[model samples]
Target: MQEAKTILTKFNSPTRFEYIVRQASLESAEAILNLNLGGVYVDYEPRRFHVAGKQLARGVLGGVTVDNLGSSGLELQYEQELKGVVGIQRVELSADGSTIPTEAETIRKAVHGSDLILTIDRALQSQVELELSKTIQEAQAKGGIVIIQKPSTGEILAMASMVTTETGEIVSTSHNRAVTFSYEPASVLKAMTFASVINEGLGVGTSKRDIPDTVILEWENNEGNTETEIWRDEYEYETQEMSIEGILTHSSNTGTIVWAQELGQQKLYDYLRKFGFGQASGLEFPYESQGILHDLNKWDPSNLNTIALGHGISVTPIQLVSAYSAIANDGIFVAPRLVSHIVDPSGNMERLASTPSREVIAASTAHQVADLLTSVVENGTGEKASVNGYKIAAKTGTSWKYFAPEDSYEMPNGQRDPYLDINGQRHYTSTVTGFFPAQKPELSMVVIIDDPAPIEEQFYASHVAAPLFGEIAAWSLRHYQISPFKEVQLSDNNQQAFNGQTIQEGGE
Candidate 1:
């Protein structure tokens, strides 16, 4: 290629350069336009389109056919400083080009349009980001997300995401995992379960309150073994008898499933849909998963049983938080929000409001759920998640991962799908999502750790996920300028004991 000439120009002056828009060669220009170079004026001196001697004519310039794609920041939005001078220097084009100091400086300044204001507290975001980074790295987690939302108003205080860094490079393993990843929320859905069941009049009972150890269903398999599954209310500790409250407190999958079935599939589905289960949160992020909930018309015999207990359906973190907000806001569904307001260039404020959903449960039902959830933390599986001065309610879920062949096991008696938990042996998604100041809630959060390393006999949510919630919640409460309810410090022994309790209770 012949050496190109340099040409000095100004922004939006319609500098003379021509290329057919439909030409495939011009497609590269599209990419350049999309590439955000800090939205600054760049010095353009062509290396390929230059002509001989005193530079080609301006009308039919002999320089690179550069096009001013557009400007960003205040320049484009508020229509400020639409035009700027460009510096041109004749130089040989290398395989790769770099930004000139003056051009780079201009772009950098342009990127910040009169200091963009954010609803999120910078201090909180920074602290949460730092803590999340450490957790993601240390745990070798697949990915993790931390979100703090004001339960009263549905405002997101902070949102941070981090994943494992492979090859020692900080690679964003995935996009925003919170609102995007829609996996089985596991037992975290139990809070909804409890609310719906109680709304239907099933009073809270103990986990070991003599429900039915082994319900022998008529559905049998080839092995001739009766379709009987064992109902063991054992975590890592001694198999303890728990009431309906105890069952949720302990996150007994068996008990939860039983109650879910009693509440009826249709009722459960209605409550779930009301909670925005099979829908979107209406956020601005792209590719937000809507979550899966098989239509009720196609319900199977085990559908209600499984779903009642938080299986067979899927949800995103934002969806979960928004649903939980119903309880926090006294049964009224306040849509979760990120952007507080969008301002025009002329200082005009346009509020970006979150769409509100109708109240799903009665305000009384919401208070009941909040109270029960508080018990889950005060006297249940979520005990590890407690903050001394503040009242918090939460639940832990450990899901079993089902793959191909092993997913279906046919026995003469019953069909069994054996999976494990965070402990490498076998299990499903283990997670914990909850809110704090239970009586009068303020912040709501969810923590999902795909497969945590097993701490003791069981891979429990309280053992792994709850502490993470506690840490994040405490940090967030302080960061948001919310007065600390009280100081909470877990002794090494007490924390270990709580972890051990969770492990022992993992089998309910």
Candidate 2:
């Protein structure tokens, strides 16, 4: 028995042989023992834990069993390739249920699973998670998402999603808000509007509009009755002549509406589609939302103003970031990818095909829009996102949450009474998106804080999200050893000046 155990161990087979003696006939048991001692059988097992563990980008969960692959995230996305084929064996069994090894019939070897190499940088991913967790706690936000991507390659480097529990403890979630949650993008869409205006031969310098604090529209309802709707800016600005760059810098809703009106509804819709709004990002993420962009037939006078100001439309964080990547990539739109390639068991690699791309806007138009965004980071709403020595191109967004009628009002049951805040409750989604080394961007990122508290100086994107962006951007640059484009002077007030020159606006 000791010699048999030693032989089985040498053959990499199970060492226990008492079960065979109990279950098999005397002759079969002798045959099994002889086969084991001869070192003729071997078992190759598969792994249960593959890659980084649970909720790695919101994957489904199942028990750790050999047959149970992960249910969500990349696990589900590439399950076919990850789950290798099972091997099969056929043998003549004795009446006692033990195999007669000398009469073994046939066997088919297993094919090992292919390995997936993601574009994610594990170290950078950890850093992003740490910073995002801290920011969500400091702002007392309900949830948040941060995404870092390479503009030239459309490879997602890091994705972090964190949410606050009912107990007020912050934790990472499996919801993957960056690719799933859709909401009004607010002023972030203004950059797309400005880009469209520049692409149609309507020079940014030549395009000027007189904007009012409020716009009143009268239209006929479906019942043929006259309806009146009022659209107002967040704050009252003087009715003055403003250029496209000024509109983006100040984040003026009225200014954007005026330009959208001139650009026409169909043209604006086409440009928005081209920018990848209201569409899936093609990353093949499970349950990924395409967001909401009403068809042209659904358009009304209110939609014109609301959509222009990013009210009526909804967009996911991935979709928004991909569109910005196009601008950063000099107007070429490349679909974003998560998995870089797969390595088969044969030690050969199968690289994923390059995602299709097209020129959405002229390179010059993209550069002009990028320059306008630079002004925003330098002297406008995104000032908090500015790094010390990098020419950052960025935009800030603040949008109100939409409450459904059923949620706003209580039912006839013993529930809370229906009520609406006269000034609208102070709930906001604050966001900052940008690309650094503005002239030739390497990294583009977006940070979103959902429903931050109305605490003093904490509700706006500039105050909440922009600071987080600056921290992550600065750290990434230094970690990646990116050289600064210009000398920077940091004052005690935390303000940064670049080589004694503020980035000048287009048409200067």
Highest-scoring model, lDDT: 2
After superposition, the stretches of candidate 1 with alpha carbons farther than 4 Å from their true spots are 1-118, 168-174, 204-209, 219-232, 235-242, 402-428, 455-459, 481-508
Top candidate (TM-score): 2
Ten residues in a row with the worst lDDT in model 2?
A: 16-25
Please give the CA lDDT of all the candidate structures.
Answer: 0.62, 0.80
RMSD, model 2, all Cα superposed? Answer: 9.7
lDDT of 1 by residue, 1-508 (tens): 1212222222333744432232234456556556753333233221222122221111111121234312221112222222233443444433335433452222322221222233455566556666656655555555566667776677777665555555644233234666677777777898898888877777644223445444334444567655543343454444335567767776676777677767888889999998889988755454568999999887756667667667778788788887887888888787776556655545666665555658888888888888778788888778778876677877777766554445555445655544522222564456777887676677788777665455563357767677778887777656554553443556779879777442211100
Mark the 10 consecutive residues where model 1 has the least summed lDDT.
Answer: 55-64
lDDT score, residue 178, model 2?
Answer: 80
lDDT of 2 by residue, 397-490 (tens): 9988776655554445735432322343547899888887788788899999999998986789999999999999998888787776653455
- Residue 360 displacement (Å), model 2: 1.2
